[model samples]
Target chain A: MTSPAITVDRLTKRFGAVTAVDDLSFTVAPGRVTGFLGPNGSGKTTTLRMLLGLMQPTSGQAIVGERAYRDIRRPAQLVGAALEASSFHPGRTGLGHLRTLAPQVGVKDARCHEVLELVGLSGAKKRRVGGYSMGMRQRLGLATALLGDPSIIILDEPANGLDPQGIAWLRGLLRALAADGRTVLVSSHVLAEVQQSVDDVVVIGGGRLIHASTLLEFEELASRDVVVRTTDYQAVETLVRERGWSFDAQLDHHVVHDVAAAEIGAALFAAGLEVHQLADHGADLEAVFLRLTESSDAPTTQFTGSASAAPAAPPAPAAPPVDGTVAPPPPPAPPTTGGVA
Target chain B: MIAALVAEYRKFFSTRLWWILAIVMVAYLAFIAGVFGFSLTVDTGADAQASNFLSPKEIAQSIYALTSPIGYVFPLIIGSLAVTSEFRHKTVTGSLLVEPRRSMLVVAKLVSSIPMGLAYGVLATVTVVAAGAPVLELVGDGAFLGDGDVIETLVLSVVVMALWTMMGVAFGTVLTNQVAAIVVVLAFTQLIEPIARVALGAFDATSEVSKYLPGAAADALLGSSFFSSFGGEGGGTDLLPQWGGAIVMVTYILVLAVVGRLTTFRRDIG
Candidate 1:
């Protein structure tokens, strides 16, 4: 069966006086990967934990399909999640961990092998989890999460510890899983990885929802990205930062976003620097996310999109400061499309 | 609930902790029972003779008794770890994820713990007998295993040990922290309860209460205990009947589970 939509309705969670999640709500649609994006300490994990019923919301509800998670009948058969990659018991073998979860979801023990192979851990199935690397443990965690073949899969930082090739593989895998009509919500602080994978995004900061939008809106914002390579790389970087526009550093030079390419060329030519590779590689979700999260020029608010309506972009950089500090963003998008290098 | 139970059982097999501790328990108890048996038979020096735990004849009747109580510690650790390990390893997230209903999860752990405890109890029971019987034959005057009472005592000892295990799991479920649960289990089962029984028995008024303690009840249910022999102001004649003690032990397990279901187990897992 395909996954049903996940809806969060004014979910508020307070640990003592500190609210980890404040009156937040959003919908995660089936047949697409929804990126649960936030900076560190943004309450992403806390919210996910609440959704899975690992933690209780101080008020309100997170619903899976028609009912709350706790009220969901045969929940194991409907939802699967890996809230953290380190959830596997250290002494258990990879296969053993899945076996432990299989019967709970009413899946057969043989499914253990099926998932072990699916996650590429069949060879190391017998090896104790303690000996596995971070990447291997992540795979085992994924294996366990998928043990039941649930319709909705939630993974927090699923690409963490994976090498670049593995990250690429994960990108395809998540898309593939979503293509199968399952609801997949993947949480990550690193925007670069998630942007390529997710179809929709729900961003939160300071325990409140900042924006809910599709990936293309973010990509459209990113398409305005301009890269500049000059003799004096440092000079262009300082110029971009001084203008208050975000920039990401790279091996050759830097990629600057939000500002026009004409503005960048004008600044560099006026500075009398040798320009080599000033190109438009388009902005990614990373650029859009920083604009939405980092700029704390206003108080926070949430915007959820309709089924057919486009996502309303929040103020660039943030509804509020992610940490009340507009730290620098990640390096500019890799020159993947047309490059002038 | 049954699915939860099956998951809990699978969890026991998945982790190496259970079986590793089980083997360690069996080996240690077997070695100790054999040593106790050999030492009791010969007229050792004053210190060794003073340490003589049971007569060879007593050893034959309670062949499973000597090291059986010590082996209770393993099952207690197992039962407690069953709950605490989930938190320690962060598998509690996965567990609750797989089974969202906390009450059913608690029930499953409770139901599954009995059989797991029995698994530990059975291994220890078998080891106690396997290691003790031959030593009893070499040292005791009577033929070992001659009476039906020996088998009954062995069976009761295993049952009581299993009960202790379930109790440990209850403590674990309620405590939530692994180290805290271990400390309490050891301190209470190994020291506090035993010492409390002896300390409280000093007062006639409190002596009646001591008999109702888990340790005292366990002794009563098993029909014999080393501590109960100190009958004056330091021991109890006030303990309930064997069946009553069993009921009291079950009550303790039930109270912990019900209280946990109401509080700790229902709290946020992460």
Candidate 2:
């Protein structure tokens, strides 16, 4: 159990009458790319700002390494953060912007150029930031964060405004950073945006911790629903009910929950039900993320065995059922879950 | 501290505003000085009337010290924009990320403004001299650049510019909004303070207080100004002695800086 690189313990921040971050707590382990996942306006940015000491927390602690971010003597060399893409001065050239930060970060001008090239901004290094496209700005931001070559890197929405190819490039860069044993925490409002790069996830919604676990564990949370198109909807519904599987009945199809397509097909065949079409509709992680975040009433749960560190349960009464069939109550409208290839 | 200062200097120089403002300051001071040099030296057949009030040497001294009365606003604006521009463009976020100690950041901004103010001061002084010297030598008493009082006034003009620049930084720290700071600075320096000083000085009771106003104190610090000499005899207001003016300016800067640190500077940056 190596010491966590970042520890957020019961951190809370309130902006006057509104609480931006509730008593949220999570940790990112070293040597992995952890996705700080949340929907927009869910206190993700607030939490990250608190972690970086840019904003003071109302209560609790956001600790990095052995001390608070401000307490660190040379924080830039230890923790590199690019919290937003718009923080750059529009009139400054990309290299000039990094050069301004270089002396303060205790990095040389040569290191600034290195990070520029690392982020593939060498060609545009001399261009003013105002003229750079949004994607280019994000890359320059990544370049700024990498200037100090810190062991810990935190970026908020690094994929925003990026083309697919650029996002792919970012994904590779994040993975390579993690492979170098750096604790990389990249945040996004969408799960699929960071799905392939993240090894662990710390999810928050409504400013409260919703789930925290390895990517595999989070992926498993996506309820696999089997949609069976059958000639007799009534019989298919009856078969699903007899099997004790929850399902939503559509006009000509029955979307079965918690049962695999293979098992449902076998059950229907044994019953001599004419199944015109039986397909597995695997819910992508993004849909699961939307479900969890969209339903703010979803119970706050931690799956990393550190639930004891989390504050008392939120007001939500229904805990995820022990069977893990459905984490939250089914949405008001059944989600048309599709596989994310 | 060194890194913070270096960062601040870099931030100041990396923008176009500094040079643009410097150019404007040069042009502005040169124009004002030229006007004063011409108006004072030009024999309008009212020479008898003007000489009875101010000596040729005094008129020459007034032109040299014109840097404070007319050109101080540039350093103030430059100083202020140093802090306010960060807030305007949201670059303060990056600044704080590099140096999280907010007080240190503010102090760096204050210290960094000195060189900038001095540069503007030198430029303003040079412009005034260039524009005023030829006219004064040709028409009025010789360009009294070598006079003890004129040299002191010239040097103090530069110092006064630096001080005003620091004041601008403090003012910007308090306001934090770039437009509001600039508007307040322009209004107070160009309109509000001057008018208020004249109005306040019309009364015997308020005349002493008027001398301590920022503009008055700056004039007193320089030891001479066209406005101060214009109303020297009949004008009831008397600016504080040079030392008194220095104290007043320093007090204003310190108080503003402290107040800014306690209020806006301490607030969490979003």
Identify the candidate with maximal TM-score.
2
lDDT of 1: 0.75
Label model 2 with its docking quality class.
Answer: medium
Q: How do the residues B80-123 of candidate 2 rate in per-residue lDDT, one tens digit apiece?
A: 88888889888888888878888898899889888878888888
Candidate 1 to truth, TM: 0.83
| TM-score, model 2 to reference | 0.89
Q: What is the lDDT of residue B97 in candidate 2?
A: 81
The best candidate by DockQ is 2
TM-score of chain A of 1: 0.75
Q: CA lDDT of B30 in candidate 2?
A: 83
* DockQ per candidate, 2 decimals: 0.68, 0.72
lDDT per residue (tens digit) for residues B56-171 in model 1: 55646544565444666777778888889988998888888777777777778877888777777778878887887777676655535656777777788778878888887787
